[model samples]
Target: MPTALDRPTERPADARGRVAELRAVRAQAVAGPSARATEAQHAKGKLTARERIELLVDPGSFHEVEQLRRHRATGFGLEAKRPYTDGVITGWGMVEGRTVFVYAHDFRIFGALRKAYGGAYIVMESQSIGADLTYAWPTNETAVMGAEGAANVTFRRQIANAEDPEAARAHMVKEYKSELMHPYYAAERGLVDDVIDPAGTREVLIKSLAMLRTKHADLPPRKHGNQPQ
Candidate 1:
């Protein structure tokens, strides 16, 4: 009797062949125009997903896993469309010799739509292998900034209609209260481990990596799905 890692005695070769065929179909589907288009878009941005990962990790130390997985969609009308890594790039690598798993949104393709298979695989793998740290930088800050600016404009207009200029002053106070208060709140809640100057990002990451190396041994294993249980 063969083990699961080998060939199971119960399963037929036809079934295994079908599995291999489906994997091949998935790879072929996503390896076409969509993948090329996505790469071109990233090139235009002067930032490939892989380059971003390289910058974030230690030079010559990062090792990537699962670089070839692609989207598997069989939905109506979408069956013909290949989603190109489901619009997200995921893999594990070393940051200053510390192991970590990362997933970055590919804003150039499908706006980071979740592919059922690839998405689930990354999520499950990350959970099982675990990572010392996770980092997420929003790729769509332009939209967020626009919405915030619009809200500020609306508040200013409303303030101008007030009977007292003091009321208008209060609007300014409220605006800062909402916007500027968050960073301090994040620090207090420990949501942001640290906030460092942009120029010091490399130094900060190095220090963080050092700290994690020593600290990781003391910390318990990370739970799957990031749940405590």
Candidate 2:
């Protein structure tokens, strides 16, 4: 038999102690993001990553993988912000009693994932030639109005000018959303090529592409590249 020194130095008092340790570990896993981050997510009318996983899977069935892993990517200043779980929560869980794997990342906290279908690259390239566009609703009105500090200043002035500040702000938001978000207005202003019905999108795009195939315009040479010594 191995001597005490040859055996493990750290040991739980009993089976119950080991079970308690496991509970603590599980608690940390379930905690997900910081309290402030969780609050911000809820404020945006979105569920937390953990919550999403819970909903996606049957209750009490989520078995998280790499819950305690941390990103080792370091340069400039990224080492200071090494993300836990590498900013992604991946696991296997039961959905309707069927086992399914899940990979969820909070785009708000990290970055977005882009998925494209057939001809999407060409469509996006054509669209990129025009003015940039953004969409917002009352649910995320703050993003629409631009920086909160700047928006507050403008809103304050508008409130001062109006007889009822509260009512005026609400009216302003509605009017702004209506006026700024219409595709027809964007087309008229040459911000977009045109808007077409979803059902006829493929047909319309084929015709547009056929005409654009022969269309050409003088363009400047590319400049960005690795600099020569």
Query: Residue-pair clashes per candidate, as listed?
Result: 0, 0
- TM-score for candidate 2, residues paired by index: 0.40
Cα lDDT tens digits for candidate 2, 28-88: 5455445677677788877766776776567899988987576666676666554456667
What is the lDDT of every predicted structure here? 0.50, 0.54
True lDDT of residue 212, candidate 2: 57
In the range 1-229, model 1's lDDT, one tens digit per residue, is 1112233334446978778755764564334334666578666754555556677766766554444444566676554544445555677776766776666555555544322132352353333245444222222111112323444565666656778756675666666546543434333444334445544555666776787665635656756765542
Q: Could you estimate the TM-score for every candidate?
A: 0.45, 0.40
Cα deviation of 200 in candidate 1 (Å)? 4.9
* Best-fitting candidate, scored by lDDT: 2
Candidate 2 wrong stretches, greater than 4 Å:
1-29, 111-229
Query: What lDDT score is found at residue 212 in candidate 1?
Result: 66
RMSD after Cα superposition, model 2: 13.6
**CA deviation > 4 Å runs, candidate 1:** 1-46, 59-61, 73-80, 112-190, 195-201, 216-229
For candidate 2, what is the lDDT? 0.54
Query: How many Å off is the CA of 84 in candidate 2?
Result: 2.3
